[model samples]
Target: MKQQLPKNFKPKALAALIGLTFTLNHASTIAQEAEPETALETITVTAQKRTQNLQEVPVSVTAFTGDEMAEAVIKDMYDLQTNVPGLGAFQSQSATNSSFSIRGVGTSSQNFGLESSVGLYVDGVYRARQNSMINNLVDVAAVEVLRGPQGTLFGKNTPSGAILVSTVTPSHDGGDSFVEATVGNYGLVNLSGATSISAIEDVLAFRVTAFGSQRDGTIDSVGNGSETGKNLLNDRNRWGARVQALYTPNDDVSVRIIADYADIDEICCGAPVQLSNATINPDGEIGSDLALPLLGGTVFAGGDAFYDREVAVSFLPESTMTDKGLSAEVDWELDENYTLVSISAYRNFESFDNIDTDFTDANLFGTYNDSKQSSFSQEIRIDYTGDNLNYILGAYYFTQDLDLDYSLYTDTFFNEFYMSSLGGALDDLFAGINAISAATGGAVAPVADAAPAGTGFDHQAKQQHESYAVFGQFDYELSDTLTLTAGLRYTDETKDLVTIFSENLADGSQSPEFFNSTTELIIGAGAAGVAAGNIGAALAGGQAPSAEDLAALLPFQTAGWGFQ
Candidate 1:
């Protein structure tokens, strides 16, 4: 007979007998009339650079432990808004375009030169860019959201608020591990795991953690192309990993190091156009009457009659991001009442987005952005604790380099539509000129060919930024229930940006006739001492020329309409 492993076995209850004996022996000594006492658990937070009871901190702050976050299924920065009051978070076409607001104060612009008013810090190291702030939370120990201005304590840009994230540290006594998996609708799958080990008993330890999630798109893409009949909008595909190490050779000093990386590649972010009661033409026709024909008879589906979660596109939208960073923190106890700390970090982030600007299958226009940023920062602080006084002093230095290459382009369908419109407008212009010539007895010129097709431009921008600050905060206890708190910060910053624009056409061809006709009309009218308004009235029949129209015409006079 083959040997078989035991499938089910019960061990003897040895602990129960031991417990019974101990209880019998201690029954006479124990007091049966005493009632157990209970008290609320105290929560400790580090919002002021030192640990303190949450109820004792004077700042307007909210904190959540890792267990609370896991119980609530908080996975990333976007999920914090649902649980935190007076906080708003939104991700636009990509992670790089994310926005975070605290009490209705935040930065929403996507300009490469701007910084967020609400600062984000992980392990006491600043995450200067929006892309760096959207990574999945892995092995998080605690999160603290501080409302109102925190410029003195956090430094950099924190005029609105600040978010602080602390990751679990590697412990000398290890043997910690866990694995979790979750599944949901729309083919969603999430998996994460973490493990810790001690390499040198009391001197060194290390921990490794990883997480990933993916879900199918919620919106449908319906078009006459290969992408038709596919759920290709608003999908999720991302993964990340982190490694941490701790070292404490003696009782007075400790060091922690962390390295992390994350990636996101997904087809995302387009909304259906609602045409109900929408106007698109000067004659006040409904938007669908003018837009549906242009979309080649594409119809909306999946929800209401006029509004739904369906998008029609000739090209699918795409967004991808890569974020990686390394940080080191050191803490040393100088004496019984003073401690010194230092944090140094370096990060690199890159994101690319291809979006359909027109939100239709007409292929009118599209935008592409390729951006990269590299940053380095250093902070040093010293803490002083006395019987009735506590204070912290710190200095921070940061530098970054950013590069953006942007392009806007049109296709054949857009070129054809533009040429047709340009031809009709030219016809009307020549008719007015002919009538003027008949009245003035001057020569009438024939209309010219429409301007060159497939017009587009490309530009590359580079920015360098550097900043440094010295900040300090102090608190003094005046009595048992009263305290005085004061803080100050002085910061200096500088930035430099340079942009280079490419020629309109790759072949560098010129449309001289197109420029000549338009420029001649404007210059001839101007040379005759006619006012700009009169020139506009004579050419357009009544309306004054808009600033944009005049700007477009002014460049053609000398530069010949070439983007330089």
Candidate 2:
């Protein structure tokens, strides 16, 4: 082009050639200007109440998006083990009852009356109960695992760590719908879908997501091979749905209304194979009493006595769980430097189980637990953002009403230990009576059999609790490279409880209704004709066990539990 166009050439021709050359070279220039998108993108997290790059946060956290979880095939809380380091999940008979551990530290207690060491949350809502937190995850936006103590900001003071579940919020821009179905072995059927509609363009949006799954049992439960019982020690029938509404009135205000419900019905909980009875060993070291030989005579001997798919349980069992909740969250931009947020929620949880406790096909032992709980919480917070300081301050009020109906039924079959104690008491009483008769030089009423060697009991209880707290956290950018953080919380709480305990005779040969009938076993050691004395001595000073006296024992549980 050294001899290109002459200075007097047609302006149009020169312009067209230059334009063509520019177009041909534009792509090459773009290629030189644009860098490859190969570098990993940094994740943003709100674990600290402030948006920041994941790597920049001072806490140890692992984050995953909904797409990432889908790619990894993580469908529920238990599936979190796939990526969380130092974490473990034990899939029990019921998915809701699954256990989670972090660095081998987790609460082994499954008592509904207690709180967990690890905290679980959904969209900034604390799931106080683990049973309610184990439901199938719905269209999640992201999941964050915060390792170590997060007491300053979260609802509960979780020393073990926190599992934060952030579900996808209703979008204001578009509409989309998807449905998926999966079929697998053991009759596994899973169906999931979600739909979103911008009901009023930029002003209102609604989203609904739901899932249903059912699977065959892990063990072949014989179900007592009868009419009243069901297949035991199996998987669960589970389903859940979530609905959310997003309202945006201009750019300065936003509100979200959410409601969710989950229901599960299945037989669960398989007892471990008893190696031996509880006693000193055969080497005269420890008895067999502590280790009853459960599978010593099973087909698989010398190896793991119990079969992989064979639990060998013979009984009818029932297990069911229901969880439902509703919540609302509001965000108001006070200005460019401040924002106000309010989260109000109410939730209910209940699980009922009628199970065989002896782990055998025998009808000797059984237990029924009817647990119900209702809880409500309200939180209002103000967050500040400035060049020199950032902070979050909130006032929280939380209250929960709990009702636990627990009953244990067992015949004389497994009450041998208690019966032996009863026997010893009878023997001592007989000796005392003989001694009295000889000393008084009088004839005593001759007695042959004291009473049938059987014992049982019935227990019922109720609990209530209310708690309130005011908490605040402050972070100051003292300097560009150094920051200071501090926080504090104050709480006020009250609790009320009432429990009733009664004695009843063993009910093996009697009707199932007779199991709860309290007409037989003597109350307490006083009326049992034990070593202390007989009827005469008992009536002299002993206050026999009565319904009226049980009120004093109802508040046995600790009044104030630790942080959430």
Candidate 3:
């Protein structure tokens, strides 16, 4: 089964929800002996690694307040895009991974080799990959969408831009907690709650927040009215919690620790039925030998051609995914003009095994087990606020390790029977079989052999990456309101990827069929062939191998291209 995300959400309704929730919750926080509302204290932002008025930041940034986020049901990164302009996200038609694009800069291809062009960071910890975007985040303070090139401040392959997420920290405000829930169409339900408490009078505090959501499928299966079997299978469910503790011994110094986890479970995704082009014939023939004439009555007693022409998403699975992570951040104020900050984080994400794509009724494939990926990072920064010249400096370090095990199966007989049933010895193997039946003067078409049972191919890949960067930004008050800012960063990154392929078939012996086949085609035609791998392989191969050659090869393996 295939799935598509809702492109247009109810923006007005989302805004109304956030507005109402914020009004109700904030009404309780209003102070009685309040100082005169001195021009509604402008909200300051520190996203640029420097403190400045939100409006004075020389960048295209969409800042979402906690009030706006609550009103729009913006519990996580996925929901945040609904209100931000020029930003979009979807579970690709390929995997449970989210495809994100800002101003059309994201990768459209589904290959895992290429990560997203946009960087995602939570609490100063860079989310190294895409699967982490699968679930809702808990206790978010604010989300900043920084558009355009940000490599100077954040240099993790974000050719487009980056999303900076900051979560709420524990406060000294004495209080219990509160909870909220939501119900909607498609069995949609959401529950969220949070609370804060002072552990030591004005010295120590702790806060906790959590969220969960679930929904049934909106699409229906046509073959069988089996709604139960498919409803929740294609739906989504996610939940997570965060806890934080803050300690302030004096007015100039503070320490904080925070941890969080998130998970998403939903059937994998599949592409839509868009278009189909005829497979090219190698005999210089425009169509297949089995191609049916216009009349069509002569073939198979007026029935349609034996082969059906349809556009299909080759092999997909009913997939589920889980994402979880933890991180800690600390802030220290040295005197009045100097400050320091440090953050450390770790994250893990994986996708469950299942079949989500239905290429043809004859051949189907599924994932065998969950694929896992993990990463860790640390960063430190120091800044000083000066009257004439303001400056900030920072250094970052990151590491990641990944382990993936996946499988594919071709479990139906129709495909093998259609192409390989004819025996090699005689003009027609069906002749002898029909002759025996003719002895009784009865007529019956020759029978083809039952399609061979499906074959299985599995793969394991391990990847490691390390990166470091040092950056500095300086701002000069050129005039009074006309400030000039400039920044620069130096970064180095290295990646090591190793792939292991193992084949499982009727023979029981393991071979590197899948890897050999794909790599051969990719490396054969040089860069030109590699470029074609981005689109279609058969077209790149040019010379289609015989069915016999293809059958002898590993299932899901390519034949025409040579291995490097």
What TM-score, over all chains together, does every model reach? 0.79, 0.72, 0.72
Q: What do the candidate models score in CA lDDT, each in turn?
A: 0.69, 0.61, 0.58
**Candidate 2 lDDT, 68-124, residue by residue in tens:** 776677778767876899766663433334555677777643455666678878877
Clashes of each: 0, 20, 13
Candidate 1 accuracy as TM-score: 0.79
In terms of lDDT, model 2 sits at: 0.61
Worst 10 residues of 2 by lDDT: 21-30
Candidate 3 lDDT over 352-411, as tens digits, reads 656533332224333455467788888888887888778889999988887777665444
**lDDT, candidate 1, 363-428, per-residue tens:** 566778899999999999999999999999999999999999987765545544554444453444
Query: Can you rank all candidates by lDDT, best first?
Result: 1, 2, 3
Instruction: Point out where model 1 deviates above 4 Å.
Output: 1-39, 271-285, 288-292, 295-303, 419-423, 428-454, 506-564
